[model samples]
Target: MDIGYILSGFAVGFLVGITGVGGGSLMTPLLVFLFGFKPIVAVGTDLLFAALTKTGGVWVHHGKHKSVDWKVVGLMATGSLPVSAVTIYIIKHLMSVGKEITGLITFALGIALILTACALLVRSLLLRKHEREVESSSISTGRFQGTTQIALTIATGAILGALVTLSSVGAGALGTIAILLLYPKMSTLKVVGTDLAHAIPLTAIAGIGHWSLGHVDFGLLGSLLIGSLPGIWIGSHLSARIPEKILRPILATLLLLIGLKFVLA
Candidate 1:
């Protein structure tokens, strides 16, 4: 048990729990761009880290009966699982070109980060708008059900699957936004819980695929997990104490800086 790695994991995990952002979105870029991890190794390790962290979230959500929308989860998994497999296959095959492949992966990751940032920005605005509308409305609504909504959800899932495999970005804030947009009638809490539930399996399949390709770094994964578990526990406990009005802006700023760094790197 490397104390340092454990601490780092704890920190990342805490952020994930507090913010409901996918660890991969933050952890992968942090590992590669800041910590000098190889791009593939960073991606692989982060996938596993994401899987491990989300596992706990899934369990808690399930135990409380608040972690899922089975229909939505099934739809997402239907599209994502195969896409993840295909994306991994492409990466593995492309790596035959060696260093060039790594460069490509890094570029993809950068683009994904930028996209994720944009998604987060859009989500914030939409949620604000939704909040305003709800306040003005005399009644609360139930889940959205329509052809357009279903189609959009499936499309969003497909996009997330592709992006997650390429850059490990879309599964967090991005996925949540898609859900919010497609199912505006649902409460925020339910959306977040359901999204996390779906992400667990989606990430697990993708992470295992990466592992099979010999891309994952077990030592790095171990370190991240050690740190993230406790970090998440503390973050979850403190979530109510923090003000979203303050936290949202800070998180948005962080995302902007990170996105810019990746683009520039």
Candidate 2:
């Protein structure tokens, strides 16, 4: 019943709702730096938190039906799932070697954060460029190219699987940017939905692996959920009124600062 943890979750959830980034990127750092949790514990907790939170999102997206691209999700899962399994085995093996894993986790988290910041900053620009590309390209059965798009999607998913398994980051922000770049003709909302749909399984596998390694703290997870569920709901309701152009750069800057701090630490 730590009020501070609950409040932090609320804030993170609100920001995630508006920005569509920061779930794993910000939450793990907050737990590690502010709450003084171990890097592994923070990452493990956030992975499950991400999985559960995004489940609700997937439901919403599926309800809309048009927002989610199941083909994309399938391709991503195909690549990501196997990599996630291998990463879990590697991390468990690393853990058996003792305290060395902590430093590795910290290093990975910092690198992922820097990448997430850059992804956020460039996300809008990518979207605009994508729009232009879409206008220039001819309509094609309302679908992307067959083999090339699938290959890129799987490759992106493999990257996400490895990074998220290591640091519990990249499934959201980095995933968004990669998809937008690979499938520039996709609608923004569809890209988000597909990414989210893929994240549930990816995070759940990683989370469960961490749990088996005794890194997850269920009490902390529950407290975070208590605050974040309502916060995301409220933020999404209010999102239309906010100016995204102003918000994204600021968020990116904050992520850059936090990432730099972790790297320096």
Top-lDDT candidate index: 2
Candidate 2, 210-243: lDDT as tens digits: 9999999999999999889888988888788899
Report the alpha-carbon TM-score of model 1 versus the true structure. Answer: 0.88
Instruction: Give TM-scores for every candidate, taking all chains together and pairing residue i with residue i.
Output: 0.88, 0.92
lDDT of 1: 0.73
lDDT tens string, model 1, 2-93? 67667767777777767667477678877875578888888877877787778777777667855466677777777788888899888877
Model 2 residue 45 CA deviation in Å: 0.3
- Candidate 1, residue 130: Cα displacement in angstroms equals 2.8
Q: Residue 90: error of model 1 in Å?
A: 0.7
